[model samples]
Target: MRGRPAALLLAALLTTPAGAATLPSASILSGTCCPGTLWTPDSRSLLFLDGPPARASTGIYSVPAGGGAVTRRFSSVAFYSPDLRWAVRPGTGDATTLERLADGRRFTLPTRGADVVWSSSEARVAYARSDTTGNFDRRTTRVFVANVFGAPRQVATVYGGGPTAWLSEQTLLMSGKASASARDRTLFALNVQTGARTTLRSALGFRSVASSPDGKRVVYTVAFDSAARNGLWLQSTAGGAPRELNAFGSYRWRDARKLLLIPLQTDGGPHVLRQYDVGTGAWTTPGDLGDQVRQGDWNVSPDGTRLSYLSARDGNVRVLRLP
Candidate 1:
């Protein structure tokens, strides 16, 4: 029964949970939905760029945590505030736009052509600038820091890469290719206060590096080949060899003690979402929530209590809630 394909058995399992309460039914916001790229700090709202005509006309939509109409569409992509009061519009082009949700006041950021990230407190913004080219060009990517409404400050001149993550109030994590071959990527933790750069990881073919919420651990996926059968690894922020977990595919740290993993079979299909107990080295399926939904991205909340995944069922993208 467990060996059945996803498309055949997914709907039947939607109402059945092996051990927990039945998962929530999903609602479709539009005729089409893309895999979301950003999840809010509280893990309650999801922001994704929907495309059909292909241009800046792509809009962003937000759905409730318990599920409802996905309101609030914007001409540009949206990044929610830490308090969910406003959304910082890191523009897709030369201009930067910030939108206030309460009164709908829009502000333009002074910096031109940069990648932006918000501070932990949401009172400051950090950014990096890169050459706007569509070629095999070599250019220096520099990091900068600024208040949410003030002038920009140059923090560091990172040669090849852009900003990655903020380690502390003054430290940041950045990465770039080690050589022109584009085969090797390295991770570094840069201290803004002391101008010290620390190498974190230098795996040969690593990608999707994520810092934990507590900022003490990092989880990333390393692919052995282009086929994408990668191993999920967790390492400490203090630096050490990463410990590889048993299951493979996409993974997220639900908390420090547990991890959520989607184990993919050889045919490139996810079979189940499994929770890994770090202390006992035990892997348990949360519940038999039925078949895996195709074309859906799964996310576990920051508190590690709920799992939200978007799947294509009956030709529409429906968001599902798991136990």
Candidate 2:
């Protein structure tokens, strides 16, 4: 009888493990309507580019995050401003067109085929024009900024990777080499108005750079640089010593202070959602999806309440209510 009671206790413990990491999710779309999908600024719907064979014509489409009938948002595709206020369409040559969605007012920029990164208010923009010929890491790239309807002005030059993200209205966070033959790349911030630069971090190479929503902090990954240099790091844009996160994987800012990450564990098990609180300097594994995210196709909503991802099992989009 005592052995039977012990077995029953073991069964209960197995059924309800402590802090089990499984999270339930629902599908938002099926049949692979699009590959790279983006969430709307409001986080109510997802936007994707699609065309005939499945859709009627080549354009931008949107579907609600709650799952509903699909609808067309824009007739033609363009690199849209985050606020959906402007559509930037690059042409075959040096000129790119910017159209205001409200009044249909238009202007052109000499951005070549590169997309312009818009400022927080969508009032100013920055872009890079790189030398077409030469080894990619050695080629010189000129960064430019222009006000809406204003002429483009050359600001700075960096070799290799150019402007990665706009930290603020007048500052740009970039990574590149000092010279073509330089062994290491430097991640620096540039003030477009004052022409000032602040060196943040230096390494052999950097990947997956991202800025916080408020533009006060940045996170990035440095891999294959050496055992000590590899992993994810968080630093302030205002200049401070960097704080390295203990974990590594795909990450996105859930808000100005919280970051969500899915560890790069390819064990064919459920994908886990780990949250890092920048303010408290704490880490917690809130939950895990019972599926794999396809090709890192996952994003946190603008409000940081929900998450959406492409399911690897069925090749469809799924939405999860973050725990």
**Candidate 1 Cα misplacement greater than 4 A, ranges:** 1-63, 68-79, 90-93, 99-113, 133-138, 177-183, 224-230, 266-270, 278-281, 315-322
**Model 2 C-alpha lDDT per residue in residues 1-323, reported as the tens digit of each score:** 22346556334322322475788888888888777888899899999998888788888999898889889999977889998999999987899999999999999998888878889999999899999999989999999999998999999888887887789889999899988999899999999999999999999899899999998899999987976677689999888899988566899999899999888755576777888999999987787787889999999889887899999999998888787
Q: What TM-score does prediction 1 earn? A: 0.71
In candidate 2, which residue ranges exceed 4 Å CA deviation? 1-18
Q: 24-141, model 1: which lDDT tens digit per residue?
A: 5455344545566345666676656765563335677666666676654566556666556667665565577767687887667645645566656766667777655633224556
Model 2 Cα shift for residue 34 (angstroms): 2.1
Total clashing pairs in model 1: 0
| Location of the lowest summed lDDT over 10 successive residues in candidate 1 | 12-21
Winning candidate number (lDDT): 2
